[model samples]
Target: MQRANAELVRSLGAVRVIDYTKEDFSASGHTYDVIVDTVGTAPFKRSRGSLGRGGRLLLVLATLWQMLLAPWESAVSGKKVVAGPASERVEDLRFLAKLAQEGSLKPVIDRRYTLEQIAEAHRYVETGRKRGSVVVMVSHG
Candidate 1:
């Protein structure tokens, strides 16, 4: 992760933020019960050694092959690979909204652009250096 983003997550109570550019967290001799790979950079093979027994690897952006191999991997290793779309139930969304409204949930927004600048926004995001959510403003209000 970028340095600024690392600090942002730290401020949000992240126990530790591994800057992959400088460190290889998996080789650090630490084990975790759950590792969430939001960007799909950490694949099952690369992360298997870092997981404790019965640990879960949640792949938010899994490839088709990874999804297909998840069950077999889990069966053999006792570590689970969960790869799929996220649940977007209304109640869950409402709960998140409530948390945000109550100031209990803080979202990191790295940048905002007007609707007209959407193409530029996409270009920037494609660079893969963005630290947090990039908002596209549809209206002034």
Candidate 2:
């Protein structure tokens, strides 16, 4: 697990950052109120079991099957699946930015590459092993 990711999660009130590479969260016998699967590494079917009653699974990168099933599942089950693109609201964006500025929210920056090394950044992101955002340093001057 990336230290930045672990720290960021911890900073945002995470009791624990389960390293999925080391341990299987679903098999740990602990259910969660909300599970945010950003990488789409854990499929919705396997992860639904990890949610408590009336819990939510927020998928940032969902599979076609999961996307198709989300609406139907929400209508029929207590566990809700929230997937797809988020609404782009100016107020929401500014609120989040302000939180970051105030140190209330800290982004986990996995790696930084110069503008000259943008391709390297893309390659790293494509690997999908990045714990957080891969920053490309662009010089505006």
Candidate 3:
């Protein structure tokens, strides 16, 4: 996780950053009020067990399979798991823009490549060593 978005994590006020790749996240013995699984991988399927009592798991990239499956699991348990569509509306974009303008947040730019270098840029982004977002410089004349 640290390697995935180190700079963004640092600047975003994450006091303690854990590397999920190094160890099992559940073994940490910590509970969260809200679990936001952005990537929808790894322990996301097990998020219910890790949550504190009355905790909620918010799945951002919810798929049809996950949506149907998660609801069934939640119905039998006290902990609730809710999945939202991956679509982003204007309000969401506005909020993000506000955060940026307020200086509360900024996207970490791992690399900047010209539009002509898109293939190379994508290759670099796929390396899994990216510190943050790989930017493609696209210019319109």
Each prediction's whole-model lDDT (CA): 0.90, 0.85, 0.74
Candidate 1's displacement at residue 23, Å, is 1.8
What TM-score number comes out for model 2? 0.82
lDDT: the better of candidates 2 and 3: 2
Residue 35 CA displacement from its true place in model 2, Å: 1.1
Give residue 29's error in model 2 in angstroms.
2.1
Cα lDDT of model 2 by residue, 85-111, tens digit: 778999999999999899887777889
As for TM-score, the candidate ahead, 2 or 3, is 2
Q: What is the C-alpha RMSD of each candidate to the true structure, in Å?
A: 2.1, 2.4, 3.2
Total clashes for model 2: 0
Give the C-alpha miss distance for residue 6 in model 2, angstroms.
4.7
For each candidate, give its TM-score against the true structure.
Answer: 0.86, 0.82, 0.72
| Order of candidate numbers by TM-score, starting with the best | 1, 2, 3
Local accuracy of candidate 1 as per-residue lDDT tens digits, 13-129: 878678878888799998888888988889999999999989999998999999899999999999999997766899999999999999999888989999999999999999988
For residues 9-111, what per-residue lDDT tens digits would candidate 3 score against the true structure?
Answer: 8667676566777866667788776777767663345776678887888887788777876777677767778775657799989998999999876777878
Which candidate number would show the highest lDDT if scored against the true structure? 1
TM-score of 1: 0.86
